[model samples]
Target: MEIKFEQKIPVLLEKAGKKGMTYKELSIKCKAKKEEGKYFRLAVQKCKAAGLILEKKGKFFATQSKGLYPAVIKRLHKTYGFAERLEQKDEVFILGSKLKGALAGDKVMIRLSKHTRGNLPEGEVISFIEAGEVEFTGIAHLTKGGPFITPDDIGNFDLRLEGSVKGVADGDKVTAKITKRGQGHRDLRAKVVKSFGQATRAAACCEAILNLNGVTPEFPPQVLEEAKFLAQRGIKHKELLNREDLRNEVIFTIDGADSKDLDDAISLSKYQDFYILGVHIADVSYYVREKTALDEEALRRGTSIYYANKVVPMLPKELSNGICSLNPDEERLAFSAIMTLSKDGKLLDYDFKKSVICSRVKGVYSEVNEIIAGTAGKEILAKYRDVLHVIPLMKELSDILHHNRKLRGAPDIDTAESKLILDENDRIVDIVPRQRGEAEEMIEEFMLTANEAAATLAKKLQIPFVYRVHEYPDGEKLNVLKETLQALGLPAREIKGNVPSKVLSDILDEAKGKPFYPIVSRQVLRSMAKAKYSETPIGHYGLALENYAHFTSPIRRYPDLTIHRILSDVVTQKRSASDIKKRYSEFVGRSANASTEAEISAMKVERDCEDCYKAEYMEDHVGESFDGMITSVTSFGFYVGLPNTVEGLVRIEALPEGQYQYDGLMELKETHTGNAFRVGDAIRVTCSGVDVNAGNIDFVPAEPESDENG
Candidate 1:
C-alpha cells in the first residue's frame, strides 16, 4: 500500500508538476508495469476529484489557476455580493443586478470585473454554477392555476408551484424545494416537499425557521438504528483493554445548568510547585467509527447547535446524551489529556491516554460559581463533598492560565450572552444576561490548554490533522477596523502595515467600560478572520497561539472527533508515520472543506432562529422606549443593537433632511448640518414596528429627557 500510494500520487504529481502529459505518455515515462498503469489512472482521478489536479485536451497537469478563481457567492443583503478569491487575500465585490438573479449562497464562477485594476479588486459573477438544492420553508397560497410560496428567509423572492399541490392549502406552512432556478423576469417554481399545519402557529413558525436554514429535526432511520445499537452494546471489557481505569478519581463535569449533552470532565491536584490537570473528553470515536452511518450523519451536522430552546446535536441522543455523555456516577469511555503545569501555568509536560472515568458529580456552572465565591449553600457543599478541595485548585490554575494568555496578547472579547426565558406557551417572557463566572472561565482555560497540547502533539507526529486556525483579516475589513481603532482613541499613526494581533488586544482593552465597547469589540471581531478547521497549521491570530485544534468536545464538534480518531491511532495504537499519513491525507483535505461549509450553515440556522424569537418577543414591546447603541452605519441607515442582542435599523430619513454621506471613518454625516451618527453612539429609541415574517425591526429615535424634539 505504501509503494502504491507514493508511486501513483506523489510521483505522478511530481512528474506532472514539471510538464503536462497524456495518460499513455505518463505511464510510459514513469516506467511502470501495465497493472501499475491502471493504479496510476485511479490515482489521477482521486487527485482530480480532490481538486489537486486539473485536466485538459486529454492531458493531466497540476492545478495552477491561482488568480481570480471560481467561488461561492455570499451576498450581503440583496443589493451586492462578495467572494474571497482562492489566490487573493481580499474579497471581490459583485453587484447584485449583475448576478443575473443568482441568489445568495449559490456557487458561481466569478472573475475580476472588466476594466478593474487597483488595490481593491472588483468582480462580476458571470454564471451560476450550482444552486445548492436551494430549498426553503414558507407559507403556501392557492392561486387560480396552482400554489405559490412566500419564503421565510431574508430573501423576499417568491416561488410558484411547479406541480399540482396536494395535502397543502392556502396559508399552510410547507417546505418548498427548488428543482430548477428561474432566470430574470421568471418566477421560481418549486414543489411542496412537506407540509406542517397553519403558518400562524408558533410551532409551525419556529419549525419553518429551522427548515428555512436547512436543519432537519429528524435523522435517517439507518443513523438512528446505529446509535441505538451502539448504546445497547455498552462498553465491553475487551473495548476497555489497554485503557486506564480512573473510576476512583475525583473528577467532575461543569457545564450550564440546563446542559445535558455533557462531554468533558475535569480532575485537578497540586503536585509541589506544579498542578496536575486532567481534562477527560468522551471517547465518541469508539462508538461512531469511520465510514459508518452514525459518523456520516455527524459529519453532515459538523457541530451541535445550541438553539435557544433546544439543541440540534451532531450525534443522536442515544450516543451523545447516553453512554457518550459524562454523566455522574456512570463509567464512560474518555480520551484523557493529562498535563503538568508550573505554578505560573506554563505547560511542562503532557500525555494522552484512553481511559474509563466515572465523574463524581455533574456540577452546574451557577452552583460551581457559588462554590468558587465561598458562598456555597448546605446542599451544594454536601453534594460536592467528594471534590470540595478540587474546585479551588481548578480556580487557581485557571487564573494562572488566563493571566498567561493575557500576557501573550490574546484578545479578550468574550461577550456576555443573553439567556432567553420562555413561559410554558413558548412565548419569550424575559431576557437576562448570562454572565460567565469563574466556573465557566476555568473550564474554558483548561480546554484551551488541552486543545493546544493536542495540536502540538499532532504536529510532532507529522501526520495530517485538522487545526482550528484563525488567519489575519485582510482587504476592506482591515480598512474599516483601522477607522474603528481610531474611534477608540488610538492614534492614527499606530495603525500601519501588518497590524499586530497585540494591537487589536490593546484596542479592546482601551474600549473597555465605554458604552461603545461592545460594538467596537463586535466590529473588530467581524474584522478578524473566522476560525475554521484546516488541514494545515495556520497560527491562530485571535488567540495568539502557534498551534491549536478543537480537541475538547468530540461529542459536539466533528473536527474534535476527527482529531480523536487520529490520536487513537498515533498515540494508543502506535501506527507507523507513513501508514497514518496515507490513510488520512485525503480525509484531512475532504473533511476540512465539507465540515467548514456545514459549520457555516449551522451558525446561520442558529442566528436566524434567535432572530425569529427576538422578533416574536419584541412584537409586544412596540412603541416602548429603550436605549440602544449604533452597531454599524450604512448608506441607507444605521443599525442599533439593544441590551437583549436584538438589532434593528433607523433609516437615513430619521436624520436631518440634508443629504447624508458615509465617511471613510464609518460615520453617517449630514452634508449641510455637519452632524453625524457614528458607531457606538448610544441613543434612545422606541420600537416602531416588527416585521415578524421577515425578522425585521424598525426603530425611531425617542426625544431626549430635557428636549421634546431636539
Candidate 2:
C-alpha cells in the first residue's frame, strides 16, 4: 500500500500547466491512494529537502517546473575540454540529443527526474526558453538565385537572403537585421540593412564585431540636430564673464600627434609653500545639459570608442571635436580641479570649480618626449620653450609620485602596446611597439593625481559618483595560476585569499628578466577581474587606491562629464545633500552600466582592427618560421605570439610528429617522447596558412631535426 514517488509527477505536471506548480502538489496528487498517505507525504518532504522539488502554493513540483521534458544541463568548459554539469536549486537538464541548433548563450527549458541520492540530476532540453539572434554583420555571398551571408565574427549561424536583398554582391560586407528566427529545421532569415564596400577590411571587421556585441555606432537624427545647435552657439565671452578665468594661466594640452577632441589641460605654478596644480577638463555637461537629446544620446553611447584607424565618438563630431574640445587659443568652459600639494606629493588643499580657460599651447607627446630628452628640434623647442622648461621638474615629480604609489602597492605592469602605422592609402605600413617613456609617465601620474583628488572630494561631500573600481583577483583563479607558475619552475606563494596589489606587484617584479615573464605576467593579469565603473565605492586594487574616478577626459568619457557636473554643483553649494544624493545616485547607476558596455564594445572594435592588421602583416610571410612564446594555454591548442606581436594558434594535433596530451594542472606534453610545452615556453613555429577572410593564423611546430638539417 505504498505510493511511489515517480507515479505522482505526471499528475502534478498536469496541474502545473504552463504557469508551473510547487512541491506540495505531489501529496495532494497521491491522496486518492488512501492507504499510502504517510509514504506520499514523506516522499514530498524528502524531495523538498534534497532541492529536487520546489514548494509553492501548498503544492510539490519538480525544481525545473513540471511541463517540459528534462535533460541535464552542463556548461562547456573550453579550457578544460569537458562539460561540467551545473548544480543548483532550480537545476534542469538539456539533453544533448535535443540541443537542436541552440548555441552557447542560449537559454533553454528542461524537465527534471526524481533525485537519486549522491548523484547528478539527469534531464534533457525540451524547449528553448529564448531566441538569441538580434543582429548579424558579415559579407554577402550572392549566388544566381539568392544571397547568403557568412558571419565574419561570432554568432556563427549563417543567414539566407532573398533576391531583393541579394543585390549585395559577393565579398560585400553588410549589416543584416534578423527578420525571422528559425523553429527547428529552418535557418534564421535576415535581410541586408546596410552595405559597406569590400575594399575596407578593417571597417568590415569593426562592424562585424559591433554587431556581434549588439552595439551600433548609428546616431539618432534628433541627437545630430541638437549637436548642430550646440556647435553653432559656441562658448561666448558672456559665458566666461561670471566664471574664474584661467585664460592667462600657463595651461597646455598634451596628446597624441594626430589627436583631436582635446579634453584636458594642465598648469603648474608655485604658491607660497605649495604647488598649485590645475587640471582643467572640458565641461561637456554644461552645454549638453541633462535630459536633452545630446545628453541622452551620450548616455546611450556611454563613451567614445577609439579603434586603431578610426574613432566612434560618443557625442556627435560637431560637439566633441569643436565646442567641448579644450582647443588652444580658444576660451572654453571647463570643470577644473585645482589642487595644492607640497613638494613631496602630499595633498594639502583642493578646490573644484566650473571655470573658463584658454589653452596657451597644444603639445604632442613625441615633441615633449624629445624636449625632455634634450634633443628637441629648433622650431618645436622655440614654440614650447616656456612650457618645456618645467618638463624636467615635472618628470622628477612624476617619478616621486610613481614611487609613492608603488610603495602603497600599485602594480607596475609593463604590458607592451603596439601601434598600427598606415600610409596615405590607409594601408598598414608597419606594426610598431609603443614604448612608455618619462613624458608619458609624467602626464599619467598627474592625471591619476587629479582623478584621485576628485574622487576624494566627491566622497567627502557625500555625493554619489561613478568610480572606476578594480576588485581583487578571485582566489580560485589565483590558485590555478599559482599552480601553473610553480609547474614552470617559478616561485609562487599561495594567494588564495584577499591578495593585495603589493603582493601581485612583488610577484611581477620577481618574474622580470626571465624568459617566462611576459606570459606569466599576462596570465596573472588575466586572473584578475576587469576594472569597471560602478556607483558603489569599491576600491581600485590595481592602483592600490580606496577611491578612484575618471575626471580628466570629459570630452571622451561620459562619467567624467557627470563628475564635472556634480563637482560644479558642490562648488556652488546650490543643492541640498539629500537632493544631490538622490539625483547622482541614479545618474551613477545608469552611467556605470552604460560605460562598462561601451568600454567593452570599444575594446572589441580595437582588437578586431588589430587582428585585421596582423592578418595583413602575415600575408607576405606564409611558410616562414619564427621564434615565438606560448602566450596562452587552452585544451584545443596554445597561442603563440611572434616578435611582431601577432598571435597564432598551434593546435594539439599539429605537434611535431608526436601524440600530445594536455595536462589540466601543468601544460601540454608529448605522450611517448615526454617532451613538454608550458605557457611562456619558447618554440619555433612555421606559419602554414593565413585565412585572411576568417582572420585566423595557422601554425605548426618546427621539428628539431629541421633545425639541424638547415
Candidate 3:
C-alpha cells in the first residue's frame, strides 16, 4: 500500500502541473484514490483528507512547495492603498477583509481559502511583506495615562505614543516614527522624533507631502555642495566656440507674469517662402554632467515641482533661478532647435545644435496679449518694440495651427483655474482663472511644431531619444464611461472602438451651460491613461500625432535635458550609435520610474497645500451657509464640492429628517423622502467647523428659507 501511494504521487504531481488545480481538485482526486487498489486507495484517501496535498483548478498538488504555500495575494504600495500586484491569481483577493495592521501604503501577502457557492476568491492574511517607511506628521496629544499622535492627514491611522517620546505637548505639530506594529488593534506604538511649532506650516506641509508620496525632499549635504560648485563655475562663452551663434536673432521668452526661471526662448524670421523658427532651451546638461553628484540628485528628482506658493526645484536655487535661467540681456548657453516651416504649419527642414543665445526681450502672456489686441501699454511698447511688431502675425499663424490641430483631432481640454495670489504666510488668498489667450496659444503652437520637427528629425537621423507617449484608454473604463453618459442623457456612441479626440471634444462642447459639465469632463479625463516617458515612440493620443517629444523646458524636465545631451553628442559626432543606444536604454528605464515617482510626489504636495489652504479658509467661515455640488458618491456618504472648489463629506446619517437608502440602480436615492442625489447635484449646506488638526471640513444641511409671501 505504501509503495502504491508513493507511485501515485508522481502521477498526481504531473496532473496538478498540467491542470492548474486549486483545493477543490483534491476532493475529486480522493474519490479517484478510492477506485485504485483498496488498501493503497484508503491510505491515499487519508492523506488527501488530511489536506496535505490540495487541488487548484482540476489537479492535485502539494500545498507546501519550497516552503512557500500557493496563496493569492495583493500588495498596496501607494499612499492611497492602491493594489500594486497580485500573486498566483488574476483577481484581487482582499476586497472585504479588515486591514487591521495595514497602513495606507503597506504591502501584505495573503492566502486564499475555499470559495463559497456564489462568492469569488476569499483571502486570509499570510504575512506582512513590507511596511512603507512613512513618518507621520501631526500634532502630539498628551494625557496622564499616555500620549497619542493624531495625524494631520485624514487617511492615516492614529498612533499611540511611548512614554520616552511623550515630551511633545498637545497642539504641537510633530513627526513620529512607528516603533511597534499592533496586531488586531486600532493604534500602533510610535515615538515622536521632532516637535515643530506653528511657524513650521510650510516646512511641515512639504515634509508631509514628501512622506506621503515616498519621496525625500532634502538633498544630501554632499549634493548641495556639489551644486554650489557647479553654479559658481557657470557657463563660458569659450565653450560656445564649437557651437552655433544665434545672438543676432530676435529671441524672446513668454511665460507667466511671475515666472523667474525662464528655460526656453523663441526666435522667428522669414527665410524666402518658408519661416525659420528657433527654439532656444537652457543647456542644463552642460552644468549637470553625467556620474556627478548634481546629475545624480537631478536624476533622482526627475522634474521640478511647482506647488501653490512654492517650488521644489530639481536643481539648486543658485542654478535653477540664477545661472541656468535665460534672463533677458544675459548671454546664456542653449541647446537649440531651428526649423524652417511653410505658411501652413508644415515642417520643411530643421537642425539641432548646441548654441549661444542672448534673449532680446522677456515677454509675459498678458503684455503680449495686449500687443496682439492692439492695446499695448506705453511701458510694454517701449520695452518690447520688436516683439510688438510680430505679435499680430504670430496670432494669425497660431490660429491657423490651432485650426490644423482641431482638424487632426487633438484633444483640447478646457482651461482650468490655477492658484495665483498667496498671503504673506503662504496661504492661498485667491484663485485666478487662466484663459488660453492668443499669446499663450501662439507659444504653445510654436512649441508643438518645434517638438514634432525635432522628433521627426531624430527618427530620420536614427538617433536614440526619449519620447512622451499617451496610449489609448482602457476598454473597460470606456465602457463604464459609456454607461454613465447614457444614464446622464448624453451622447456616448463615439466612445466605442478607437475613440477619436473629436468625439471627446464634441461631448465636452455639448456639456457647456450645464451644471454637470465640469464633473463629466473631469471624469472623461480620468478615464484616459497617464502620459509616460519612454525611448520607443508609441505616439501621443492627446496630440493625435504619430511622434512627439519634449524638446523644450530642459531646465525643469530631465527627459528634455537628456534629449538635449543626445542631440549635442549627435551633432558634434562625439558618440557612436551603439553608445547612444546603450545609454538611452538605461536612462529610459530609470527615467520611466523616476518620472512616475516625481509626478506622484508633485501631485501629493499640490493637494496637501491645497488642503491646508482650504482648512485655513474655512477657519473664517464656520457656521456660514453656502451652495455645493455632489462630487463623489460612496456607500457611507457623498462628497460635496463647495463653490470655492473645496470638498467635504456629507455623511448619510447626517441627512436632515430622512432615512437615506443607497439604491444601486439609481446611484443614491432616499426612499423615505423620495429625494435623489447623484454626482453633480447642487445642495445648500452650512459649515459646522473646521478640524484644522485633522485637515477635515465638516458640513450639515442648511435651514430652508422662510415664506415671506405668506
TM-scores for all predictions: 0.83, 0.84, 0.83
Tell how far residue 155 is off in model 2, in angstroms.
6.7
> Where in model 1 is the C-alpha error above 4 Å?
1-134, 143-146, 152-159, 162-173, 178-183, 196-206, 704-710
Predicted candidate 2 versus true structure: per-residue lDDT over 385-459, tens digit per residue: 668766666776788789889899887887768777776766667776776677788889889999999888888
- Kindly list the per-residue Cα lDDT of model 1 for residues 1-710, writing each as its tens digit: 22464345545645556467787776666566766666666766665544445566787665443222446655444455566554344677766565666665665656675554345567776555456556667789998866788766424556778876878878988887776656641345778888876764444566776776667778899999999998999999887777998999999999998888999999999978989999999999889899998988888888888767788888999988998999999999999999999988999899999999999999999999999898989999999999988988898899999999888988899575767778887777776777889999999999999999999999988889999899887757777777787775765636545677888788788888878788778877887888888999987988889999999998888999999999999767678889999899999877888778888988887776666667777888998989888888888889998887778889888765788998756689888888888887888888888865556788988866686576
Which of the two candidates, 1 or 2, achieves a greater TM-score against the reference? Answer: 2
| Candidate 1 weakest lDDT stretch, 10 residues | 62-71
* Model number with the top TM-score: 2
- Please list the C-alpha lDDT of all candidates, in the order they appear: 0.79, 0.73, 0.69
lDDT (Cα) of model 3? 0.69
| Decoy 2 TM-score against native | 0.84
